[model samples]
Target: MSSRRQYQREFVRTFFTSPTAVEGDDSAKMLRSASQLRGMQAPDAWIPDNEDATAPSMREEGVENIVEVVSEHGEEFPGEIHPRIVWHRDDPSTRYEGFQQMLRIADPEAGAVEHVDGFVIPEVGDIDDWKKADEFFTIIESEHGLEEGSLSMSVIVESGAAELALGDLREEMGNPSNNLERLFMLVDGEVDYTKDMRAMTPTGELPAWPELRHNTSRGASAAGLIAVDGPYDDIRNVEGYHARMEENRAKGMIGIWSLTPGQVVEANEGPLPPETERWLLDVGGSEVELDDVEGGQAYDGTELGLEELDEGMYRLEDGGEIHELDEEQLRERLVEMVSYVPSMDDIVDSMAEFEAAKEAGRGAIAMTQSATLVVDGIEVEISTDRMWDEATYQAAGTPIALFRDVHEHRPDQHDELKERYGPEVVERALDLDV
Candidate 1:
């Protein structure tokens, strides 16, 4: 098996901020916002966008804004700073312009180089193209007398060849001349990718391209890099944004591109475990939770094996004893029987218990979870037992791992996490080892 490079920080969210341009003699609004973002609480990594977000006529000015703002405020910012530079695989002049800008931004005397973590190369082609960009960073580092491989490279996959380039990374890992090891993130750029593929839709919107996301996730996992989804442009549709995030979460791609600070907050909190436990039931092939049903108005009493006792009442037999329930009580009980998602506290307790079990020479153990409710005057209970082995323990430790990473990178979020998860749970999570 080949060894994967270890990264020091977590990448839950990457916020892209475009450099501000002077408008009709007014001051730069976007540049002011970029400086103010040092106090914001979302992105784990910040990108001063100088490519697609900036107008061609103002790109040189945009580069200056990045240098000026980042040099002054990047130290106080909680996240890593990576400025997106212009690059085109087929265009020599554009590539050279980008190269020259990189040289200026990375110069030791510029004062931004010390705060800059790396550069984001956009519109890259294949593995050779990736190497070419990596070589540029290497030359820049050498020119400035900085440590080799000190500057990292993240590529935006906007073409079919760029999508396929991910698979070639594992084979090219052993090359010592280039800084492929410095590669950090594999970010998808869906809009340009759609144009590159010549794809079209009735609505003229970007396709979901789930295969691309899955491939990106798999490639990131195989190469030990972070996978990030492209931006969800429907900024005002907050629910739609979260729904998209849930989909990306299912594919193990926690990081995403944030176009606004609001989106950044959502993306930052999207990956962490829920604050409270939730239950769901399969109702006619659709999953329904307690929140889905409004006052039990839409539910019939027959769901989840509840025996209807009256027009608005029901009875449930818990191992033979009968307990009476009303419409609202019945709806609540039914949802709890089908599925359960553990909360952060629940995870910490389980991990702590599992550690104790392992120390006591046990390979596996059965853990029981129960839900109880009062019906009429009797207490009815529903319980579940899951066997936890080493594999299961490791799987449950993902949230803990993410928490530790956040705790390490963003000390500003420490009090917020403690307030959310409690100090005991936070401490235990930081101390946990897989």
Candidate 2:
């Protein structure tokens, strides 16, 4: 909270479909407000005078200002283009189209352009691919006479392979030889990740928590780059969206994408203080200051060494391999080793966040006593206290509807509700997923 805003690894995310060239000036004919950004370079870049008529200043009729959003979040989330990798695979030309979009997004010869700030690259699978991208952009910048770092870049990791290569990705980004910006981890990679693990349930939760936890921490912290997280997919699931952004914030991610305009409020929230913040103050194993020894391993003693092991990971060794731990595992062991009592304020804050999280997740399924609920005149025993057991799921009587949280309409089965509730109830029932 300073009078002058700080320039951290900032981001402001918004995306608009590049208007189809064939759609042209007539595209603005449907409009009240400008459908196109004036003064922005076209996604196809410079137009051939004979073939193209729309200028860099937008079609004259579409010249009225579009809505502008200012971020009160204090962190600048400047507008940027998201260059997707699928285009690269589909055809090289389309990928370049994305690049053209990036170039024109913010660069305006006239007045202030559309606040274009940077770019985020999606689905980087390996270091080789990353290096190629780095070089590609380097050349592109040179060609455009754009100074280095003028247009920033961030990469998203969503696939399982990309998940594993996160360490290498961060290491490469931090290598100084490369100019790749932040690495963001999308938590619910959904089917993209699940298809590899073959383990995702219908609810879209990745049971592999460590796969996610370490990705954000290692990428965001180790590489010292802005860590970005997923846009909580459900636009209407405000509680769930807030809870997720909080988790991302706790993991040190500076930003989360907004799936809808409303969800930007959740992404804008500052994180509650991180549970444990540490630095390798004593590099060569020296004694440091100490407070009341809490649950963490008191490290005031000498012989503590934090050194790089594999890329993107540091080992906390007490002089040798006899006791070595990575960041996440090390924290767990320290918690078990000591009961470092935090100040009452810290305790209160932690508990409050904990309860809020519990409320957000389990809050959907209200727990009450057993009751007979009739759906379409069919009586079914419904127990709010206990969800449907494995036996109940298998029994296959009248569709056992435990839809309090909308779990019954599994991702694969849409009409199951319609099949059970009949046309009348189906018409009247609230959309639980909403």
Candidate 3:
């Protein structure tokens, strides 16, 4: 293939993964949207013992601990905390360490094109320690060009003062600022019966902490600042991404759902929006179903042979001859498949038969690992390639192994190949773990 075509193919495959690649009117809008919905902030703290303060090796040990964090997560970026501090502080250090680690990962240089939508907190007291937190956030703001809504505080409403001040803190820090993004108040600690009941039942049911009640009387707070509140126990079920997605979507806040490999097919399989389907068809010239025809024998939920219904439309027939459908139904289905990106699961399922055939040495799946080849230092994924150059591999002294055959022979030749080509040239193949 020519370089231009190769570049075009790569551009499409890797396109949507980048934040900037998502549709937006302009750079400012993209950046703004990212700031509001995509940034992830985590806080960590480290507590040092009195004896450790005087120990000569304490600092070195601290550095090693930070190194472990980075090693597990990858390299830290410039302007982010030097990992040496993961173990350096006491009280608020763990939260601080996590914050730095997340920031390190968020740096573009670190290739963290995506952000964490969750906030991680290390302890309860540290969550309420604002003075110390202010100092830490100040350093963060100065080091990285963070926008408001990019970072949040995991507040712990342990003490009466903390609970009382939660609203105030939230109102103060809700919007974008030079110093920080946002604040989240998480209540964690031993709680009395009255406080628990009141927190759970709504504001008026139980007697409130005097300090907190007095603070509330003082004023109404702004949104976004110290926005996260509630009984810690109730919050547990809603902490993770799936629950948050549902909640956010209900609130009209879902822009994109970051999917794992398992969820991708289901996510993609969703009925496509009419406009999007039209756009994709116009742009990509994708195959469309023509009409409903008897799908030979029903071995599965799907009919074996699919019939195109119209331009960019297809229907599955289960032994029945073509039947006329209302225009509305046809338009709806046309809109669906055209816009639908199959869920990762469905997509994988759709390839099961082909992959099985490839494994059995019958034929290769058009766009899977079965169709990939390692060339030079890159992996040429040929699953999307319209035509295969079977002779090319035969000429290169490389055997045209079926997906299974390659695995069977991989261990024997892999080490030798790596030695001869240098690790970089064989890295892609090795990643297949065959």
Candidate 4:
């Protein structure tokens, strides 16, 4: 098994710094922002960006700023800090400079070494290129007398070769000298990737290469590492950002590159289950009302248009065809209509109920959820029964695991969780066993 530290990875906010000081200020902008991030609550991981975010002329000073600020306040920062180091697939001199900076920053004498989690290497090419970087890290650890594999590594899939390199990690893990197991996240960098591919668009905008995102997620899952999507540059479009997050969540990519603190908050809360219950239905590719009924059609019981047939029956109507369903059949149909994403409270309640059942010597049980709607002043009931076995319980463990990780790593978010889920539920979640 891997010895790398595992924690919830939701938001990665890159702190960009410039060498030039703002007018009327004595220090660089990066120092001021780094100090501010020490107290922020949203970013689960912070990246002190020294690559694209910093001007080429100021990179040396940028490294100094990282060493100074991180050494000063990193111990108090709640989030994991991974500084983005300069690197290139084809250039040796740039990689050498990055190595020298790593040596300086990771020196045991530097107070920042203990607080630094790892480094983010960008513009990676292939598996060989990856191993070269790993060797560099290994040498750094030995030079500073740090434990082997003590510092984790995350890489950006910015080139086609890097995209293909992800598939080779499992095989490479067997090498005795390889520290592939210490990898943490596979982050997407679409801008450079587009440049690498020589791809273009009519409007000169980066194409949404969804296949790349999916492959990144699949690769991360296979390697048991976190997958983070590329940054969304349209920061002002909050709705668009949320929409992108929804798409990423569907692709099993829960973490995102956040450019601002507000984006960090959005990404931090994006992967978590909703605060309240939500059920949606798609009828003929259109969303129809579930609570209100008109024209003798409603979607209360299934994705197909449902109409009340009798006291305990429903008619499944689609394109003028009808099929009658009895009470038991309608109950099963309701299960199909339940496009339900469980709330945090709902998950905790289910886990608690299952634990009680286990204590009573039961291996499995059926959990029932019901919904009541009043249409035209007449009450209608919709209900579904789901089997909760060991498998089901294990599958439901993600949200609970995330909650526990947050409680353990992000103490600043504790009060927010308490306010959202109440102190009792939060406490139980932290104490519960999977």
Question: How do the residues 252-317 of candidate 2 rate in per-residue lDDT, one tens digit apiece?
Answer: 554555543345434432232222323222324442333323332234444554454575455555
Superposed by TM-score, candidate 1 places the C-alpha of residue 408 at a distance from the truth, in angstroms, of 0.4
TM-score against native, each model? 0.87, 0.43, 0.26, 0.84
- Report the C-alpha lDDT of model 4 over 322-420, residue by residue, as the tens digit: 779886675555456445557788888899899899999999999987675433333446666789999999878876776676677778777777887
List the candidates ranked by lDDT, beginning with the highest.
1, 4, 2, 3
> In terms of lDDT, which candidate is stronger, 2 or 3?
2
User: What tens-digit string does per-residue lDDT give for candidate 1 at 32-67?
Assistant: 575566333447778877888877888788777777
The better candidate by TM-score, 1 or 2, is 1
Model 2's lDDT to the true fold? 0.39
* Per-model C-alpha RMSD: 5.7, 22.7, 21.0, 4.8
For model 4 the local lDDT of residue 94 reads 88
Error of 3 at 200 (Å): 18
- Tens-digit per-residue lDDT, 88-196, candidate 3: 2244555555456445543534433122222323223322355455446555544655443344444334454454444555444433443323333332222442443
Model 3 scores worst on lDDT over the 10 consecutive residues at 6-15
- What's the distance in Å from true for residue 77, model 2? 9.2
lDDT of 3 at 271: 15
lDDT of each: 0.77, 0.39, 0.30, 0.75
Return the top candidate by TM-score.
1
Candidate 2: give the clashing pairs: 11-77, 12-77, 12-78, 294-339, 294-340, 295-338, 295-339, 295-340
- How would the candidate models be sorted by TM-score, starting from the highest? 1, 4, 2, 3
